[model samples]
Target: MNIEWSALGSVIIWGILIGAGLPALFALGVKTLAVPAGPDGERHPSLGRRVGAWTCFGVIILAIVGAVAFIASGGH
Candidate 1:
């Protein structure tokens, strides 16, 4: 049997990077937007946190859209 070691390594590396990286980024956004409860049980995320979360979410959405487009276009 013949095996393409380089191709296999590349797929493994990229699979881990993208598979883990996107979720890690989304988790970071969730952490950024989280607020601890105050004495009055109120929580408010800062504007920066809101923006960061939205930006992270936007990137995820964009990636999904691009993937769908690529599949629809025959992944050329």
Candidate 2:
């Protein structure tokens, strides 16, 4: 049987991105949120770091939801 190389390649790329990339993104989000407070005495981090962490988490959540929806609808 002949293999469709293009389809295989596409699957490989998407798999890597979704599998490794998503987890790595999640780790980065955790790391971003874990940074120490300001030198003097700030308990919370700056708004930008908080936003970045949330944005990364949001993207991952969206990706998960999208995958579920796609599967539910019989994804292509």
Candidate 3:
């Protein structure tokens, strides 16, 4: 049996990076968005936080779409 060591290593590394990194980023975004309530019981996330969260989500969505497209195009 023959194994492509480099290809196998690349896939493992990429899978861990993307699989873990994306969720971690998304979690960070969610954490930023979760603002604590003030004295008046109003919880407001800053505009920057909201934007960051959306950006994270957008990146995740784009990645998923790209993966789908790659599959559709019969990429390895």
Best-matching candidate per lDDT: 3
| Candidate 1 Cα outliers beyond 4 Å, as residue runs | 38-42
- Candidate lDDT scores, in order, read 0.87, 0.89, 0.90
- Measured by TM-score, the strongest candidate is 3
Q: Which candidate, 1 or 3, would have the higher TM-score against the true structure? A: 3
Please write out the lDDT profile of model 2 over residues 1-76, one tens digit for every residue.
9999999999899999898999999999888878676777664767998899899999999998998999999865
Candidate 3 stretches greater than 4 Å from native: 38-42
Residues 1-76 of candidate 1 have per-residue lDDT tens digits of 9899999999899988878878988998889878996789886888888999989988888878988999999966
Worst 10 residues of 3 by lDDT: 25-34
Which ranges in model 2 have alpha carbons more than 4 Å from their true place?
Answer: 37-43
- Locate the minimum summed-lDDT window of 10 residues in model 1: 37-46
Clashing pairs in 3: none
